[model samples]
Target: QGMVGGMKIPLVQRYEAGFRAGVAATNPNATVLVNYTGSFTDFALGKQVGQDLLLKNTDVLFAAAGVDGLGAIQAVKEAREAGKAVSVIGVDSDPSHLAPEAVLSAVVKHVDLVVYEAIREQRQGRFQGGNVSLGLKEGGMGLAPVRLDFPGKDEALRTVEALKARIISGELKVPTQPAPSGTAGANP
Candidate 1:
């Protein structure tokens, strides 16, 4: 419930905020602590922050920095070695296999799909590049299938899948916003 101010909000912050919102929507009583490393490439600092959070009894963490996140993942692994029950939520790509025991899930962004759809529209002479907004309905983002080695993996995976279905069926609405630039947030 506390904010960790940094020089700027990074993509990791967006991922963190999104996940935190999701977690809170599902579990209103959950407490979330955010830690920020001023730089995205500073793995050492990221690791230090992650370790500190672990020491504070934080069990689940989401590493959103590109390479910096790797450092956080390393810290989570070390904590696990010491018999700590810690887990990580990955970003961008499917990293469930990177540390199966520690990575619970990943917020997957289907860039390939977005690119492909744009290309298709261009080829069909329907290229309206003003803006494009994609979400669960548009199959833009989702949670990756949980790793087989993760505890309660089946249930975890099922929950995300069911949520996806609900989203697609209009039973659940995944919140989204227009890209900061006005030229990149249009829905077809």
Candidate 2:
């Protein structure tokens, strides 16, 4: 499916780039491990991958793996039960209620608001099917409340706020995809 406004939505690459950027900013030497379950609903596979990642010293999981994310959650629960702490950031919905202890935050897309807007526009005869990019500035997307149980929560929030400000003002631009290394226009 293509956007009506011709905006190229780079989904996976954008998310992956954002993750890499954050990791580099916070811990330059951090090792990031990524995997796919091939099926979002494959609970067994997700949990298996989750466990494997833990074995490799993964402390945080950016789980956007659909229903497979639940499997990752299960792994986090098991680890916490054994006295190991881990973090999982969710996507699609606010899953903070699922596991308060392990969920750092979730990237939530406001489906309800989007639907309402579309309907309202239709009713007003102003409906135009097109791309709508929503973010913190548009009140149509946001992170779930950060659980303050973790150390440096305040500092982390402050950093996020600063980043948000820069993004909103266009002072910082998160590339939809990372530039290939050695490209003429790539960052040196």
Candidate 3:
């Protein structure tokens, strides 16, 4: 895993860290490999990393490096074509449609909702300077519905939804990555 850019940048580490924490909370034995391509525009490196991870028996690859994530998606497609048991997890806007056969699901961050609420609060003269924490209960971040291409995803979705409910009800503790210090951005 490459930590190319500073982690303080909202888009750089927040989304990835959040997903990692979420996955860990659900699947404690799962191993998540993170690689930074320095810039979102670098697709080549992302592809290479994805391919390498596939070769190393990584079945699910999470692409969170913006445009670079597209390259990782391509690699997942190639691995699938080669009869490898590989799937991809997308970040930001849903990418399940990008490579339906390879995409299992996506992590969605509702940035627009946050912005709208903030704006509304300011307009109403009820703005607060302190931090505002938004999580699954607040409709801030969540996993997208599983892609139809993923086998048994319907059942998986049901299980995930149940877990989500538990987390919201405080019956289950959802792990969270520390928020980045700056304006929050959508994950992709």
Which is the better candidate, 1 or 3, if ranked by TM-score?
Answer: 1
TM-score of each: 0.77, 0.83, 0.75
Clashes, model 2: 0
Candidates arranged by TM-score, highest first: 2, 1, 3
Query: Model 3 Cα displacement at 164 (Å)?
Result: 1.1
RMSD of each: 6.6, 6.3, 6.4
Deviating ranges (above 4 Å) for candidate 1: 1-7, 10-13, 148-153, 169-188
Candidate 3 lDDT over 1-188, as tens digits, reads 11122223566566656555555555655555555666677778778877877776777787877777888898998888889878887876788777888887777888988999999999999989888878889988788777555677677677778878987887766433532322121221
Residue pairs with colliding backbones in model 3 are 92-187
Candidate 1 TM-score over all chains jointly: 0.77
lDDT (C-alpha) at residue 53 in model 3: 71
The local distance difference test score of each candidate is: 0.66, 0.66, 0.69
What clash count goes with each model? Answer: 1, 0, 1
The digit string of per-residue lDDT tens for model 2 on 35-87 reads: 65666567677777777777767788777666667778777778877888787
Model 2 Cα shift for residue 165 (angstroms):
1.3
Global local distance difference test of model 2: 0.66
lDDT of 1 by residue, 1-188 (tens): 22222324644445555556555555556666767677667778767877887877777877776666777877888888889888887777977666777777777899999999999999999988686767778888877866536566677657667766876888765434312221211221
